[model samples]
Target: MLGGGGLVAANVYASATEGGWGGQSGPDATGQVKSAGMATIDCPDVGSRLTNVPDGARADVDRALAELDRQTASAYQQLQASAQALSADPHAADDSVMNPLKDKRSATIERIAVAIDRVGDRPEGLESLAACALLPGQEATGGVTGGTGQPTATASASPGGGQGQGGAGQAGAGQGGNGPVASDYADITAVQPNAPQPAQQADASRGSFTSDCGVNANGLRNSDNVIVAPGVSNGAHHFHDYVGNQSNNAFASDDDLAKADTSCVDKGDRSTYYWPVLRLQNGKQERDAGAPGGGTEGNAGQIVTPKQVTLTFVGNPRSKVTGMPRLLRIITGDAKAFVNGPANANASWSCTGYEDRQLKDKYPLCPSGSDVVRTFHFQSCWDGRNTDSANHRTHVAFEGPDGSCPEGFRAIPQLVQRIVYDVPAPSVEDGGRTVPLFAVDSFPEQLHKPVTDHGDFINVFDESLMRQMVDCINSGRTCGAGGDGGASASPSAGTGTGSGATAEPTAGASGTPAPSASNPSELPRTDATTTPAHTTKHSAPGEQDGRGEQGTDDTGRRTKQGGRSGHGAQATPAGAGTSHSAAPSASQAGEIGQAAQSPEPGSGRTTPPPAQSEPQAVHGGLAETGANLWPAGLGTLLALSGLVMLIRAKRLRY
Candidate 1:
């Protein structure tokens, strides 16, 4: 019985260690022995003979066993702490401290089982069994003995035998014979879910886009280029290299172009070459390209002279010794009507007018039946790289027509015009400046409005409303109230009647004198003791007699006050005999009364009560109470039962 009990205890210990019950001491308390039929147990007692027998091993085992108890206690404390934290704030259930405590509790339970197993057949083993009963898998198993008819006898082929006879012999020696049996056990204690670990703070300085490329602005590198070939032309082929290079020439540097090269070749030839006219800095024509005296035949009433011309070379030729020269070919008649001869029939073309009008519609004399009157102009350079490989000649033929220069009048060239080239200064407006263009149609409607200032547009309406409300409130008038209550009229004019009852001067008020108009019925009522009616009359001095007929009271009563009394007995006072006596008008009285009473709307007056102050009683509250206590309570009961069995095992001699 004692041997079986010891084996059960060892099994419990192994389970506890393997399943994380062996607490936070680091090394597991149950020393795992490699031998299939044996276990190495360590405890404080038993001399060297048992110590080396894989049963008794070291003095520290007692300390470990005691620490196991401490860990178990800690586990309980952590559970209580977790419960309290969760109760304080459900959000606190995710706190960090709860995880380690939970793990330690599980580890401790395993260690306790191992410690009990180590003290097999000894007094300490009994205490270990007691602790194991509180943990998982600590159930006792029936004992096996030999044929001697005594429970301590060793097993044999015979039903019963003496000690040291068979498998029963090892059992009688208080060792786990054929190893410990596996069994299910109660958990040491239930642990809360592992708390979330703190997120690792990221290093802000590293891993940034600007760190890779020095270009900090949200734009592509300036060195990137976009090459655009010719679209169309009218007379002889005319090309304007905006970047300063000639046709079929490479740019100075990769960055010289704005984007990738686009070839319109192979697509059927375009009809026009759109070009913007170069506006002169002084806004005046500087040059003219026309025939000398009278206009040439077929070109009547045409201004052939170019008032101003600016040509920008977009590319560089290989040789610097004698740099590429400008090539200009001018045709006299409508250049657009001239068809491409066999040599250049397949070349692509397009035309654009100087003022952005469609080239096809603006010029009427061009080919392809369009209004664009085109003339051919061709220019090219040869550094041994010629477009016509078959023809070894360095000179390349170019076609130009009026369609190429939609705005400029076409004129016949007296001779082939070839001018040497130099790097022209950048147009004053374009130098060292960059402008970004976006698809205007893609912008949101709110952003497209013509606002005086972007910031003001965003703030105006809301700001105005707030300012008005504040002014009204500070003026001693509440909002949502209909009209102004009876506040002070003015310090400039005295409290009595006449034209003095104007509102107090606002900040934006004009300083103009009040007009001498009288509306006696509209005047507000004052205390009865004050003057009844004092009319403010304006006139040139001595124009009227001091006591003249006009000055006499209309009611025929002599003036007793500083001014003459009003016509008839004192006119019935304004707002007399009415519940709205506070003001001359009932509307004004109602506004004042409302302002004095109710609070503003939407003031959070109907907020719901907090849940904490009134704890909701959950359904099946009794079941919840039992469920919460089940783990710890059941663990204790099992551990205590195992202890009793261990005690009995020690008392029985095998």
Candidate 2:
């Protein structure tokens, strides 16, 4: 049964015990081996039966049970690993001979059954091991029918490990004489089509830009600006599918990044677009996961070739937007989305050719000429405050069904990611498969589950390309003539060439506005003014802002966006400081000067401190202005006005 056999806690990276405070079992809870339910890894739940056996008998039982414990944990590791694969992309459980889900489960049950025979006469160690064969609650238990929550077994079975006396004989897959294994996802249909099924809805006022980022078939990339995760040991821990900026990494500065090679049709667009590496886990474990002293998690599988990768941003039709600055990381779809409720989960899985078939855990076998796709809708309405949140969420939220945001939440360009995989058409032999689906490289503790498989993006786009994306979505035109934001109709990468991959770039791709001129009727205004109010600093695309590339200061050469704050290494600490400091050069000074006076697009009024990044106490002795000097003109006006008033009343006052 697919019961919750989670080996670790929710925060796998936090502590050795994972996340729980549950203490170890002792003479008190004699029979029960409970966990803190918070993810404590140090619990002796398997051998509670050996608690009180006689001293002479205890040592042998302990030795035999120790080996049993080792075997069970090993099986559990493989089970969790396979489960993680299935979770990320449900179709991984194909019924092929290479790796079948049922075979794994069957082997695990047999291993425990053999271990129990070793315990022989020791009833304590023998009894508890039987219970675990159930995988706790009912789910992955498969063939064993009837009854629920942990399997009930009889220790009365013979010492030799033959089929146990009565009916519990199915314990060993060896005894059942079953012809073939089965799948947990076999003939299961649960996910429903979204209310609107993500129909074609384009806010003419909210423009959209769709970039056809090239399809990459193999190998992990480590570029200048495409840093996937920083704290993960300086980024050697994982690898993602990068397509936009050639120079993308954790430490790549925006300036060096802008000139890198781009896989997108728009040669100038330097935005680094990436997601988890979708692996084709056959037998070969391709990419390295930084082993020995660096990192333990590595991915060994064939990389799936994407037929089409469309990157798009559609602004809420009702808001006026300008441009997003550098170093913005956006995430959508919860890797833990298997849990119910939209409050924290939004992972959607569907086949490109089959909209009616939506499953939370599995994808349908695509017919010939079709592919698998994962669609993600990022929170569009922002707080007009922080660029990044504590959990990398929070600061932004999804729109209501009516496409409106709650008060205080201003709308930004809604970002949408669609990656299409050229998976092979399902064959009859591919049913009941397990652990064959691929995912991007990540830590092992994450279980590589699709529910925890989320996408990440850092906007390193050249000023013109980013501005075009922001403006297109803001203006409400659906760009991307060569591609639709969703339904990918492009040629396959490194393989087939069916969907017109050879077509030239569209006019929008040429940096020209699309549908805005023909249809400009905007959506209902959310506020008194249609223009969105920004709370962070806005910079023209490519221009060096407070936090991007650094400039030479009076003191010495220092980092521009991320300064050497002696506080702590964590960027964007709560109530601490932002990634940038006071102005370092004339361009940044002019940014404060000129942008402060310009209004947000469509506002029709002078701007009020064009939205700045998350608010942090300004550090560094440098001032926003060139020298922080008062305007001489304003000072002279104040002096003249006071002198005029004095002269007019001087004679009469005396």
Candidate 3:
């Protein structure tokens, strides 16, 4: 939750605080390049506010909203291409991009209003949302600065481990002149522990259900976002790494997903889980390099598959959990938070050894032997009404500050996604030119900010499996398919406190057997079960891995998993909290295990102790951060008026 004052401050000093390493500062470098003061189009977010949309008009409204996204992407592309022209004449942005985009949006918005009016009361103020403006993206290419905000020199690094002095903008050329410059990264050790402690409850649902969904080993990549832009191709404007349901696409309906084969080891779980792919700016073009959601959209570089993916559903700390309805679709975190603000932003980043200290806006530079971790704590409170909402958020809400659901909402299994990637930490000082930089795929306008990272899930669990999950969680049993999630480890060790195992990509046509882990705790061993395999596909031709062909062991061999993500980290959107203490909780003795050594391959599943630490709790709904700006603005105006009166009285006395 960002307050109005904070939002204003963020917008005002974003470049300085976010380390806007803009274009070249001196003429000592190469030929002409896009100068700093990078700008992107910003329009009012209409979809989020349309909560009362009629079901009859849902289709029309959704399509129109998707059209809005399409319009924004196009305008952003035009802005990037016309950077030099806009730099020469500020008015050029409006004449060439802003005005045209507003016109298109106005027409689309009218269609929405008309459709709504036919079935119900049409919404007002949508027309006012049609206008757009250029937001300051990056600083003008000038003196490069690091996190310290002081002038600093920069060198470019090639993918081949080679480094050389290049133009200040060279570090971002691979990203289509967008961002993720040296200032976007911070060392993990430098971040102090900031997560607050969770409330202890007497009747908490302490158990969890783990689903062993393989990582996207079979290479299912796409840019379509079925929940937001159904039937529209490249709706996401960025590539997403997908696991679980194989048939998901832009046109996928609930039925299409329900009938699809799953990548989860359990046959009953066909849920689809996905998030934006992480890429290394190593100069190698991926399969989507030339495609709409790839290079054309400014998402360049090689895609790096996750070394591990953990999907766990845990009980609420305040109450027993209920089953999530079939076909439930939940989206956590806002993809467009950079321009839209951090109202719904929920991205949490950390490293293997430094899990206590989580970062919301900056990427962590992991030390050697450590992996980068991305955690998404989905909304845990359901409204107990519709499985989905018109705004896609109103149906589900996060619990209250006291860990209880808001009125009309019920506690449900909280889905905590912990994805691990094994890539060398980028040296932000040299702008990752010497050691290639890595970034999460993002809309061209987002500039690949870590805060913009998000994840999506559509629950397609079979009735029986869904029931089992509810039962396991409510009864306080740590259960998973076979023994995959029955083992646990120290949260600091970053092992299998989660209920699920790493989703390794399966092999061959009929699905490969779930890989055996030497230590079930290290890998969160899944049942040696294999689902019926489906044909492997990429979103488009050349959307394949451009480099790093060596796949991580599909077998559960990863030792360093994610730390026990507490609800305190996910629930506090304001980034408020005391520095977390490393002392083990009193409950850890019962929830954790002392398994010290890795089991041999094919070792039996160890029955984990009853309950692990409560899976991180996710407070749902958009948290209002700063206060409204009008009051503050009024106060400032009144004070200025008083000052004028005082000055007039003094003048009269003189």
Candidate 4:
């Protein structure tokens, strides 16, 4: 019985020591082992009797027991070592130890069970049961849930090297199982550390000429004068001429006098001047003649021939003798007779010619008539002189009858007569010959209108006042006064009834008592002339009535006029009446009323009145009292200080 028990225990110990039972199969192909009965028994079983055992059996049993003890001790020691390693360096229960320990511990537990079953009737089997409790491996313990039990290694090939692999697997799991990685980094490219580039320069040549200088050349000449030929009735005309004298001790000729004397001048010199001339004509219409049968034959009831004549002379003080010679009658033959007509007609034909002269006087030359003529003359001497002096002599002559001569008459002048003859002064260069410096050029185009002369009469009128009047008429308002007198008045409160009290409350009403005729004037009139004496007389009555109506609902009942509250007769105190009451007349009352209803100053009530005074001083009383507080020099000081501060700040920054 001992030999059998010893043999069973030895086989059990050998099987228990195998390493494949924990599913870690090594290169040594250990066969699969079967499980046995429970190692710990609750109750001992009764069996066959015990016998004396041989020495070999005893030795084998001792050896089996010893081997079992060694295995059990080793298993317990391994467990303790793992526990200590995990405590000291918590990663020691790595896969290298865990896999082998799991297989061996599982196998030993199975073998211990089998040994217990095989030696069930023997007393020594109980010791083997106790040793089975000390098996070595359990699910390799001493590490985080999915962590490898090893130190992180720097080398790639060691057992610890797999730590990096394990870590990589952990990281992958963390990312895959969760969400995206997060971090913060600045976009350095967007940072601007330098000043912005200066704006592109503009093309200097592209701007406008008038815009830069603020004026246009073409506009300057728009106001110059317009020149008309011959002349209008109230228009200006210009002419020029020359003359000379030969008296040895000669005073100036008329031309020299004109150029040098300055006095007795009736026209402009070489420059320009203005003249206005008017002409009149006379005739009797056939209706003015009575029936002619009662008149004599040749007379035809005293037949008359009307006459035409011209009268010419300077009207202004600036006329000169230099221009007189150029006055030629280029179209008329009787130049001398026309010039001295009033004198000559009286001598020729006696009373008949005088009658003709009277006829000519009746019909003054018409400026627009077809028989008009202009005259030109040369005056060479005045009282016989060649030098500039007061007594210069002059000459006169005739030029043309022109082609307009009447019936059987020659076109040339019928008489050529010289009114004066005198030798000219010696020329400065040629001793015997004289040069006429004052000679007139026949060309009419050289005489242009002067820029200063705008014309005889410029129509000067006020455009702004005309525009205002037009606007007023167009807007349906009376240009002068008194139209629809009350078109501008405010509406009344009494539904257009009860003699013009307001039919509705104004926008400002708040249920306070309406103003009474007896109320004390809220505003005092500064002008003594405008204030009423009745205000002082009714002061007591006004105050008493105002106090009684306080807090009542009569606030907006009556209409106000010139600040006065009443139906018709009763009036408020001075300054209490609306502006309308001061309209002086009922015709203008509505206009004044509308103006009063508009607004008040500083009350934030309606459109404010224009500011009538300059603003008060902004600084304290010190500034107001000090004489030098705002001296002109202080502005320069402040500007200099600002410039210095700006320079300093810029330097520090750089």
Q: Where does the lowest 10-residue lDDT sum fall in candidate 1?
A: 207-216
Best by lDDT: 3
Candidate 2: which stretches are off by over 4 Å? 1-192, 195-206, 222-231, 234-238, 254-256, 287-298, 317-322, 336-343, 367-369, 425-442, 480-654
| TM-score of each model, paired residue for residue | 0.13, 0.45, 0.68, 0.11
Clash counts for all predictions: 96, 57, 26, 48
Q: What TM-score should be assigned to candidate 1?
A: 0.13
Q: How much lDDT does each candidate structure score?
A: 0.20, 0.37, 0.62, 0.19
Residues 335-423 of candidate 4 have per-residue lDDT tens digits of 11221223212111001001111111111111100111111111111221111111011112221122122333211111111111010
Candidate 2 global CA lDDT score? 0.37
TM-score for candidate 2, please give it: 0.45
Task: State which candidate, 1 or 4, has the greater TM-score.
Answer: 1
lDDT of 4 at 435: 15
Kindly indicate the candidate among 2 and 4 with the higher TM-score.
2
Local accuracy of candidate 2 as per-residue lDDT tens digits, 148-236: 12222322111111111110111111111110111111111123333232223444234566655655422224311123233122232
